[model samples]
Target: MSRWIVVLAALLTFSSAGAQTLKVRHDHDPWGKCVGELSFSENGIVFSSEKEEHNWSWGWTDIQTVDRRSESEFSILSYADQKFLLGRDRPFDFTVLEGRGMDDTILGLIQSHLPRPVVDRLPEEVERVDYEVNVKHLHTFGGCEGVLRFGPDVVVYDTSHAKDARTWRMGSAIVGVWSVGKFDLELEVYEREGGDLLRTRRFRFQLKEPLDPDFYYHLRRKLVPVR
Candidate 1:
């Protein structure tokens, strides 16, 4: 059979086996705490999140990893075109560009781009974590409910602990990438407070593949939505 045909068959088989779910850790913002989980099967991919401080939870499923290129570039077909690029040697340059669709369409796009080897070499396990922090002005009232007005605003240190701060702060996304086999990865940190972003960081690690699919899934899903 041709390589493409074999890949398609493998994807079909994997999808039918059942969905595989992975956990993502987020520790970027001080005020916003987020943990994202994703599942993939023959049908496609699904993403769910457990976030504190938000009024409602969010989730999406039936995403396919249609195309895969090297460890850096791939494409998925969902709404417009979901593209994944790992840059020359800088995998931290990892980007998930959205096409035309609801905010949920990116998941489907990612599903359509997964490479055959990456899918075929599925690891038995995977793991990941993200951390963030935010400092915001706290509001307080003086007396009666009707007389409630802004009190002394203080900088409140918030992390994943707060159950009411789900909307991520601006410029507050930090990411870490891990490749299980050779252990190749990268870390990117962004500043989310103040009118101007004042800080940023990046790091790299060497890892191998047939790495952990679960690990990659966790990392990808944990990514803060860029508005």
Candidate 2:
């Protein structure tokens, strides 16, 4: 009927014939390791490390980050702080049928399921952009290198290795914004205590490139309306 319907049908057919169960070595930190079967389906990712006794499954929403550790290895960090390593040798076999490497394929699937940056959900009239910045959390003094994406109503900070990430909704979690210099900006956000804003914490970030002279000014302007 419609062009959109044709596109949707193609996608459905492709997905139904795509790769599913993959046998690889599975590693569970501090729990030992075993050869297991990993599968990707509509119900998220499921894995069976040892028969039916040691199997686990996680929905796409349960995953927090996926970091490529090396050319041949990657790690999945779940929201519960559990880490799973997959690769060709360290933990899993990368080789699959037709001499294809499954690492990249699996990675693509995971990335597609990750939450979009705040700017992505902005109204069409709002201008938004993404930038890489060096960041430091003031409370823990932790060095968190990541990209910052901002718009009129929201800001999302995501670490390079996906070690830490947060989406701050202006007026709800953002408390203050300060310009350190042409290249740096500081964001003060509310620290949550049992799902409630209990205190304020600061994070400092310096833009990776200082080409935009009015970057900080524009960011401040965006925050004002939302705050």
Candidate 3:
């Protein structure tokens, strides 16, 4: 029948839209954790957990914000209040256990679907770059050496320090990027401070090589939204 055909088409659409599912683990407080499946689709995000109480199915409208800093880890900020935390927003943290850990592709998909901006830390995977400079990312006490790369849509710091190497997708991750001189560059971005609050995180880089002004202008231009 014609009605049956329409119904089948709708079903297929729903299924295909949610095809990118990942094996994930949900971590609870001090020492507790659970295995589950986390999926991001056109409809929303779904968590099929072994325990029923831990299960979640949130539409985009239900989310407060989302943070994806590491390739393997991400957090979903929800409006659900935590009584123990004085009615604060509850957060769901997930870690990719299988398949490609929330790479640039997945991050892009999420960014497109979400109505609001997500704190995206996963940098764009670029093969060719416009410029690269040897620099030291400064910390309170010390710093680490890395190659700061400027690509078409992303800026990345490739360092030897584990968990220190970061990629920032231009326009989204970066609040502002400016140069103090040929030997110094500063980048401003949003980072999760405590629970789900996005606070400003500034990365100061001391460049060993001179940064080209022309390259900086070209790269900074991309931050301006196109009409």
Candidate 4:
């Protein structure tokens, strides 16, 4: 039976080397987030949610690039193409995946399917952060209160008793921030027009209550990787 045992061991090793299933958290907006199992095979990756009816799989060749959204989350696939070199025919359709305990393992497994250059470009970890800052209305004698909500793709300035808030798209805006008087912050926005400097807007914010000490620090870090 020793020969039979050796054959069995070889078969088990081959099977393990060919496929693996890992626990992960899958996220795709509108469809929402769910805990699932991600199976890695020689051909492609298969994802199955806890719900019996939900299952999807895609091949490595179908992926363009993967974006890391957080330490445990990755935008694994996106589909888009240009037409006639004019502009993109359509926007990207993203496939996002999130894993907690198995993040590194899952990421490593995915990297193995990619080329060395692509694997080197992947981030070790990522974090998504956004917040609202309290700004003071300096134009008027009796200053009004305002809040600036900073997000990944947009920045919004809302004034108290205002009909509508002013919004700015982050893509075409260059913003410079600095610490001002005790617990106050200053923001200067240089709006761009077709790669040229357009106009500038300025605002000041005060931090009355102590929030995260690293709020400003983290904001700068987030902006660096925007491009």
Candidate 5:
């Protein structure tokens, strides 16, 4: 009987160990009036948001946290990037919409609006990069678009209204290697007639670590200024 009891105890201990759970975290945007959260586990990664008077949710599967250090320090590798670093404790420009939760929505909307072939030709890693859209007429749905490159090839274009223009305006072609963090992107807004260059504006921001559940609960209660 003593021998049987010992074997059963060992099995129970092993089963409990396999049931452990993982946590995730994220940064809050005060200016934008939104909250972004990230969670992770042995299963996969999930992203959620409660802001702008509406709740939005999205996620990515087949995600594994190959490396973990502390609450604010870790690295993740996914299907796209072989290596990605996460700094949860460290705070960056959390207010910037480019790196916020709406990224997926904007990408989806733009892809839906533009030609499918153009989006298909884009590099697979393009989705991993950060971007910003400056809207002039929100109702009209027109503004400037810019993409920041982590490897190479940065592109910026404009979708502005024109008096006699048949098509949308193509902003000045700014081509250069952009750093990983946030940057001031200068794109020229042009008119349809003679392709007249209108003006250039600099958009500023910084790139922080990716969102995770462990970090989200940590900062969700705290308040950070948007601007």
Candidate 6:
């Protein structure tokens, strides 16, 4: 009947496929923090804590989305509301304390399980791209520099601004894509912004090289098919 008992019971069901585990620091507030192990498995994600009250388990269906704000930091947003936070959904923010932060392999695994868009800022160490071009990602004021790499089923924007960089799976994260001039393009993705679910975010890019018709047409056809 205890809360931790339920959490442990759920954890036991996981047939951990080596159960990718990460050492994480979950800071509850300025003065309080819980150091724990976050394990991603076939069942769901579970946080094991020494402080029993802080322990929790979430199934894939209960997750709203996952945000990889940066390589070392990420948050798992869930549908459950926190009574203390004025009924807003509480996000489990974690900072990786060990190993190579999050890589594409981990993100790929997580995205495959949850039918939700994930924000990935880390770039792959090695990738074979169908097309790649130097581009400037436009912001409200100035912008950041990055390379826009398009693969068969992926679109990656890797930038010097690590926080600005993003890797989006074409079919899952991307909603649509468009281009205006031969040098400007935009990509739309599903995101929860300002507490809005599935609210789309557009990233506009100014291509350093002319947007080749071959690449643009292929990407556009994939984003928006002919009726």
Q: Which model scores highest in lDDT?
A: 6
Write candidate 2's Cα lDDT for 172-222 as tens digits: 557678875666678877552221213466767766656254666666666
Candidates in descending TM-score order? 6, 3, 2, 4, 1, 5
Candidate 5: which stretches are off by over 4 Å? 1-25, 28-38, 51-70, 73-227
For each candidate in turn, the TM-score is 0.21, 0.44, 0.80, 0.37, 0.19, 0.84
Whole-model lDDT values for every prediction: 0.31, 0.53, 0.79, 0.52, 0.28, 0.82
Better of 1 and 5 by lDDT: 1
TM-score of 3: 0.80
Q: 1-227 in candidate 3: lDDT tens per residue?
A: 69999999999987666647889999885468899988788878889999899888998888866877688898888878888889878888888887878776666777777765576554445688888889999988899898888887778888877445777767676888788798999998765557745467788999998889898787667765446
Residue 132, candidate 2: C-alpha displacement in angstroms:
7.5
Error of 5 at 106 (Å): 31
Ten residues in sequence with the least summed lDDT for candidate 2: 117-126
Off by over 4 Å in 3: 1-16, 64-71, 79-81, 86-89, 98-100, 116-125, 194-196, 224-227
> 113-171, model 4: which lDDT tens digit per residue?
64311211122211332776666655435455766667775566666534223444454
For candidate 6, write residues 73-133 as lDDT tens digits.
Answer: 9888888887776887867788998886766667767888987888776675436688899
Model 4 segments more than 4 A misplaced = 1-9, 50-54, 69-71, 80-102, 115-227
Candidate No. with top TM-score: 6
lDDT of 4 at 97: 46
lDDT, residue 144, candidate 2: 57
Candidate with better TM-score, 2 vs 3: 3
Ranking by lDDT: 6, 3, 2, 4, 1, 5
State in Å the error of residue 201, model 4.
Answer: 28
TM-score of 1: 0.21
Query: Model 1 misses residue 33 by how many Å?
Result: 4.1
